[model samples]
Target: MKFRKVTETDVAKIVEMIADDELGKTRENYQIPLPTEYLIAFENIQADPNQELIILENENFEIIGTLQLSFIQYLTYRGRIRAQIEAVRIRKDKRGFGIGKKMFEWAINRAIERNAHLLQLTTDKKRQKAIKFYEDLGFKATYEGMKMHF
Candidate 1:
């Protein structure tokens, strides 16, 4: 498999991945939803300098997985750069092949290339497998993040 930045042509595959109803518990609450406006927003975000959206491609150049890492520069940490990782998904049939791990490594490397000092991600507490996977990759659970959804 090869890794590359996302393009407009890969949106359908990404939507498929995002809309999967089953795989892990985190997906259970997500309802696997992604609206068209979200796609437009992602397109705009991808064009910005602070975001990195990457996909893994097979021999036929079909996207098999995707991950997005966004850099956050904060004044609280003395201007240290941070990266928030999101949308990490691999095709259901493509699991156990190390694709997710590779995608994650690519994102971490991208974060370093962009001068990020820390990387963070959030998963549902019920997703034990996913949480273990992230922990195996050296990610720790430290903070409780609250969200206000509209």
Candidate 2:
């Protein structure tokens, strides 16, 4: 497996991977013509120095996973930088192969390399399996996450 920054060409595959899941099927629109919003968001992310949109590929060069990491510099924690992990998705057929664990390990190492003092992520409450997976990977459920959708 190889990890690399996602390119503009990878957006379609990323959208397909996200839409493969139950929740994503409801939330993402992967219809014909595709959505301009996704590309727009991708470009925005690409332009941000603090944001990293990554893709994991197999030996055959097929994209099997993806995630985004954002490094924030804040006054909290003595002004230390914090890394936020988001939009993590592994191909449905690729689960249970210990790939997700490897992905987190890579993310953690990447955070350390960037001098981030803390690494964090928010997962939907409905994803019990994912919650367990994260806990097993040494993430603590220390706070409640709240969001207001527009």
Question: TM per model?
Answer: 0.87, 0.98
lDDT of 2 by residue, 39-105 (tens): 9999999999999999999999999999999999999899999999999999989999999999999
| Top-lDDT structure, candidate number | 2
* RMSD after CA superposition, every candidate: 3.4, 0.8
**lDDT scores of the candidates, listed in order:** 0.81, 0.95
Best by TM-score: 2
lDDT measured at residue 4 in model 1 versus the true structure, 0 to 100: 82
Output the worst ten-in-a-row residue range by lDDT, candidate 2.
30-39
Q: Show where candidate 1 strays beyond 4 Å.
A: 23-35
Error of 2 at 66 (Å): 0.4
